[model samples]
Target: MSQTKLTPPGPKGNFLLGNLQEFQSNPLKFLLNLRKEYGDFVQFRLGPFQKFYFINDPELIKEVLVTKQKSFIKSEDIQTLKTVVGEGLLTSEKEFHRRQRKLIQPSFKRSNILSYGEDMINTTLNYIFKWKNGEERLISEDMLNITLGIISKTMFNMEFKEGADVIGEPMEAVMKLGIKRMRKIVKLPLWVPTKQNRKLKKAIHALDDVLNEIIKKRRACNEKHEDLLGVLMDAKDETDDTHMSDKQLKDELMTIFLAGHETTANALTWTLYLLATHPEVDTKLFDELNNVVGSSLPKPEHFSRLLYTQNIVWEALRLYPPAYVIGREVDEDVVIGDYSLKKGDTVMISQYVMHRDETYFKDPTKFVPERFENDFMKTLPTYAFFPFGGGPRVCIGNHFALMEIVLVLACIVQQYQVTLPDDHHDVKPQPLITLRPKHGISLLIKDR
Candidate 1:
């Protein structure tokens, strides 16, 4: 191991803003350029106060996230998320994160997945019934509605019809404000009663009231159900003999909703967009669906038979991972590879960039589900396609999300062929709390 300190080269930007302006303008494109210009390990500044190192090399990425993970916590960037989600799983650190992850892991096990599958199928079918042949639909919005319904039911064991009316619009408003606050260079104080701040407060209150009422009723009922909330309610961390408090439960519920609902919806939206743009992909997917399910709703038992459908979902994730960037804050002075990472420094890895590297994937930008024929992905290094992240904090719902996507895609594609609307919408990824379509994708829903 080398003992000397060696900094990676990076572009010089404005004296005051450093690289903040470029990153704020277009984070994905900015990061891509940094990789192209600065090689594997690139050092840059966010502002006079913040410094960062970008790790593009897969080997070193493993070192930061897995081999020596204890040396880092989630980047300070996520602290902004605390405003919306509170100190839930995504924002917590160290032993707390570990303990919470353990308590929550049971709900996502393969056994429990079978239970969630029914909810997924029912929710998707309900939403799909609204589409008529040759009708142009806002696919992004529809996906968000469908995912929000599924997650709410699976997590709380309740229908969205009851809470969605009160929670839907406000929750969406808060999310928009939350993303803006999370990325602002000069973030405004929450106490300042500006119009946007007031709007955020209203949004937060609207969601909080609905969630609090639900928690209250659940507590009073004192009965167990097969929902994630029920599991969380009864789970006592034996190490401390303590159960989740009401506040903690709400926080975790919010975190789960954001992680489970929004990310999955964006993934589905991207998958639909990809299928619409590539007619050959559409043909192959329908052929697979026709052979396997044959005009019937996709069931849990049909899981393994829908191999090609699963590949299509994986390809969509590889190209447009909802959380494009995963960031970690250095907790102590540590050596990774040949470089010394000082305490308080931030290191980031872009799943989006690594997934599209020409070195790892042939025709990296194209959507080629066939590339995954016969479990071909196993040949690649782990970091090359880590859409759900890695190590101890990897997304707990990854398996559940994948299952839901494959089943939903198989169900929808088995009956419909989606075509793009003629409005000429400039569809692109908007890097926010999740990578969403900047302008909603419009698609014509037609019988296959």
Candidate 2:
């Protein structure tokens, strides 16, 4: 394989250790500023070893995400996630990934996700019941509990409140550790007795215990529930394999609970915050809701009818994509647009940057849900608006995630009115394994 060297970067820190230190201090700011300086494809080094070519170009992004997908693989950073998430669809490789996706795809079908609508509405309503008129609550944490409950109930058919406290704690702990691990890739091996490593080990074991217990209880039952767990348990691979092992089921369960739950929660939380800050956009969303599903809990089909509401979710994701950056490593030299990408090169495409690029979106800084409804989205390239990613490896839960977000948003809109606290500052984003709100959104809710 020939090496295709990229254009010289603006500057470098050292021959071996490049911009790793600067990139670590502030990833979002660093990427944004780098875009300004380097156009769309900027070259930089990660730590002492890896070379990166940041491609914010939508066409080039599409080339990697769709056209030449097989030439690249999930970057090492995503492999680190397997430490916490295990070898589910997100972490598995090649044929294993294909098999897992085939076995699990049916579980996220429209009918199954729609069946979970009642669970979403009920879980959200339960949370709303706890909100007092004058209280200021951390909206992110609140949504976290609601979505976690919804995912727990809908996926495993477990009584969410029964396992919420136990499962939720370890999940959060592991997420924090995953973040710390990403920031600094220490030289210590996994077995070392470091605080983060110990916590990671404990957190993984705790989650595995919870999942195993759930699987055993389900297996012991006479009747089967038609949720994600049952679907995956019953699903067969293309080879007519019915033997989905307990460990396989456990990993898939962990992946769904982690990916399907918190991501939707973050999206909905950000949507609410965006609504509170932009009253006019809120009014338009309300009008759409009133005209579409007034006073009634939103059904799955109503999701398509709530066009403006869907737009709000899209725009929110555009602004604060839960998965901020996607990374892939090239296995061979390739030409993407005008640039030559070398093998062993790590590349990233930012939904954060592309969504904000003035070239693609008009007034990209403004909150405009209607922008998505136009012919623009129809004509847009594959990578232009990949909130759930694109191509064969696209998030299998795309439909499920969208449905969960829309239903939860509608449920909240119907039952209560919410706003940012009086003294609440504008929210900033922290780009991590997920794009999280820097200062959690604080909200005051009143029953509608």
Q: In model 2, which runs have C-alpha deviations exceeding 4 angstroms?
A: 1-10, 332-335, 338-342
The ten-residue window of minimal lDDT in model 1 covers 162-171
Q: Model 2, 1-448: lDDT tens per residue? A: 4455557465476777788778888888888888988787788887787888888877788888888887788887887778778798888877888878887877777776787777777777777776777677889988888888888788766676764876777778777777678666663556898987888888878878888988899899979778778888888876875658999898888877778777888898899998878888877877888889977767767887888888888889988899888898887777776668778888888888777888878898898888888755887766767899887788888987887788888877776678887788878887766787877788888776
Best by lDDT: 1
Determine which window of 10 residues in candidate 2 has minimal summed lDDT.
1-10
Which residue pairs in candidate 1 have backbone atoms (N, alpha carbon, C) closer than 3 angstroms, thus clashing?
Answer: none
Backbone clash pairs for candidate 2 read none
State, as a TM-score between 0 and 1, how close model 2 is to the true structure: 0.94
